[model samples]
Target: MKNANLFVDEAEIEVHSGTGGNGVVRFRREKFVSSGGPNGGDGGRGGDVILVADTNIGTLLDFKSARTIKAPSGAHGGSSNRKGASGEHIEIRVPIGTLVFEVGDTADVVELEESTAIVDLVEDGQRVVVARGGEGGLGNARFKTSTRQAPDFAKPGKPGQSRQLRLSLKLMADVGLVGFPNAGKSTLLRRISAARPRVANYPFTTLVPSLGVVERDDRRIVVADIPGLIEGASDGAGLGHQFLRHVERTRVLIHLLDLEAMIVEGRDLLADYDAIRRELGRYRPELLTRREIVVLSKGDLIHDESVVADLEASLAAREITVRRISAAASLGLDTLLLETFDAVYDARQEEEKRASEEARHHERVGRPGKI
Candidate 1:
């Protein structure tokens, strides 16, 4: 949990619960008692393998080494009709927002697109039993009858269950950071939240998405640092589809454009914005209609401040409001936070309203008098 890998998003794991303890077959032969009745003890129940949604774990990397998770077996029964001790249940901790699917008997790899999720771990401290332990066996004493003076046989414990599971993490975020390579999205994320995503001058510094929680007043807003997108990314070029999958659940998009590129590389600011928009549309058209705030990042690199205003006005002409900020300079970040929080709040209200409406429409159409 301490050194959470910021990269791992999916994994395949196997889980096996413990087998129950065996029952004992013995007869009372103590203190001068002849032909004592059978007194074998029953076995204890086996342990269960539980799955817990832990916020401390950041990714699925925790399961990398623990492919086969197991629980302890119950203790064996003793003589004199003494019951065995039950095994302790074992818990496997995973990050929140993880989706679990049951894999086939012989499948080595998990294909999530073809399978339905068995559980969606969204809340911290949520738990589910992945593998149930075997039942305890009965002792010979339990099998004794009036006709039979004594029973010699004891029942054996049943074997535990084994199954393969697929884990997929879908980032649950209020805001998604999106841009081309080297657009300073990572830098902005660190500037805004405590998430330590890789930041560099090179392209694709953030190979995988990482989450950051931004606390404002009494509310918390989760922001996702989605990996950079490029042209033709929507069609699975350059791990586009993988990156786009994480973006589907975001309510707002913070589209960053590098002002440094505009000044040094003579890159078209409008073109950079358009390229990302096209990729989002191709991946999912709904993503194009999400609430977006365009920000011209790395404003500290530009000597003439008017150039930032000019770029802002250029986008404003197309009815797009923009924010100019430099993460290093700590400029305009507070305003951006306020705006993003407002957008998230509005979207949350709309979501609750729609859910309430659907709740009142649970009745089936053309059944009875319901419409």
Candidate 2:
């Protein structure tokens, strides 16, 4: 069986609203009465096509293939001055973190964040009428109100228009773990959380991103482990390399390094670290700017404590704090988890602080500077 790719957020689809019911022209006549007033009833309004956000959905694969969605049409009016029944509205459920954008626009119109969980339940349930139904036409009974004795004209219902939209989803997580294949990222994740990701003794074991919730003392955080990065991952070398975009939303990054791979490449731990950093810069320079924590995995493999000390000293010389841990042995896991969690939480707070300051600065400026 083929491995499932981690990212499938972006997709395009078309949605159309229902059309209004047609107006009717009729007259009420009895055996004794020769010319009775008009009694035509108005038509009911059409149903609206709406999109809702559902937390249960993780991928956009369903909407990716769907071509179009149409709503129901309203019923026609009756002769006994009875209005037609209105059509039922259609609701579409999408995953959270979905970004809604107009087809031609480069920016997004709506961003559904986890913080908007409450708003999502309310707004997502909301029925946005992309196409409005036409107003109901007046019945012939209205002709009796004025000088016109009999009205023969009635208005027809208007049709609804279609809209094209592009939607994309970005996975939300506190930290993103990145490294080459067989780097023990999955093992580390399994050790930290209850998630049982497939652990194998080969490369590319993880085809898709796996999310795990790490809970400590009632405080929980989410972490995502993505596919291993080959040389040209940014250029789509590996499966779902484009999924790298999802990591952009993370507050911090945990970089895993397998000591064996470094040794095989004829490079030390520091060299392997730089190589991975270079790849991240190539993919997205902004990623390099995120708060990063370096981890040396497979610590148990190093039999000599002196060798571990030497590696730690080498990284420390470069002003990098390297944490050593063996996920398989469950050694130093508690320290790693606590420190990483604290770092991520601090980074998020700092980012929010900087954003608030920037907003205040913009408010003070009020307008663009004359260039």
Candidate 3:
């Protein structure tokens, strides 16, 4: 398990555009005529190296094995004033949330050099040309003037450009399932969505994030079951950045608590919750302000209902209410989905409103009237 199916989200690669073909210089010689005119054709343009955003790709794993990508070269000129065929452009498919970084021109190795953010590919089918192809050269037929009717000179084709690039992927999810390991997040995801993540009663069962779609009444909400977090998660410990960066884009968070484990270990439930909250705040203070839903999971394993009630009362007193549920028993899951969907809708509405306001401000500033 240590070396199998690793999730790669960041990669550095080298790309080169296709080089143009050389022009041809030819003179036509007829069987009966004394002299024939020059009939050399132009060379074809080279191909471009393009990057496209694909919704299906979830990681940058393909770039790990293949680091260098080059386009096809163009065809050379013909004898009868015919233009050569252009090279085919190559498209590199990447994840939708991929961020492209362009390395400096003077840098030889992309890894050791500094790079700047060139594009944020967030939408499906979004495309950008990373390196442009070379221009084709002119043939001897174009140089046939009255002063130099029999000119035998042809321009050489220009060489294509090359670039060094880095790509980083950040998952975009509507709801993020967050908790310590063995908190029944994977179980709940299996019951709610079609994703089949590894399930066990141990720590770090889910090493990578798993995305699933929960659809109800033609409404679909994407949920990401993030990896477990430990004490020093904010400082890159125990799946640190893997957990934090995925949680950044989520509009709502489902925080799961394993009551069965807590009771068996004789640990305080609030202490566990408080520790995670502290880590979240430490990593990003704004994460504490996100819409979080507390859920006491593994309800079926708890034989006594009084333990849940007392814990709920204790949390309610502290202004937090836990949604008691068991994925095995199919308990209290529909309500959680509804609340999460509503929260996602509200978040999207707020974003749209903010965008509209900013657009209006720009429009007003561009106009002649000062308001």
Q: What is the lDDT of residue 43 in candidate 1?
A: 84
- Report how far residue 16 has shifted in candidate 3, in Å: 0.8
Candidate 3's C-alpha runs over 4 A off are 1-4, 105-116, 145-148, 366-371
Residue-wise lDDT of candidate 2 within 1-371, one digit each (tens)?
33345347777778777777766788877899997777777776777777777755667778866758787777777687777777677777776666655454533544433343222222233334444444445555544556777777566666765777666677777889888888898898888887667889788998777778899986778888887776667667775356676687788898998875654554476766786777788877999999898888888777867766777787888889878788988877888888878988898789899999988988998855732
Residue pairs of candidate 3 with colliding backbone atoms: none
Error of 2 at 317 (Å): 1.6
Best by TM-score: 3
Of 2 and 3, the candidate ahead on lDDT is 3
Compared with the true structure, the alpha-carbon lDDT of candidate 3 equals 0.83
How displaced is residue 159 in candidate 3, in Å? 2.2
Sort by TM-score, best first.
3, 1, 2
The TM-scores, one per candidate, come to: 0.86, 0.81, 0.89
In order of listing, the candidates' clash counts read 0, 3, 0
Query: Hey, what RMSD does candidate 3 come out at?
Result: 4.1
Better of 1 and 2 by lDDT: 1
Residue 231's lDDT within candidate 2 is 67
Ranking by lDDT: 1, 3, 2
lDDT of each: 0.84, 0.73, 0.83
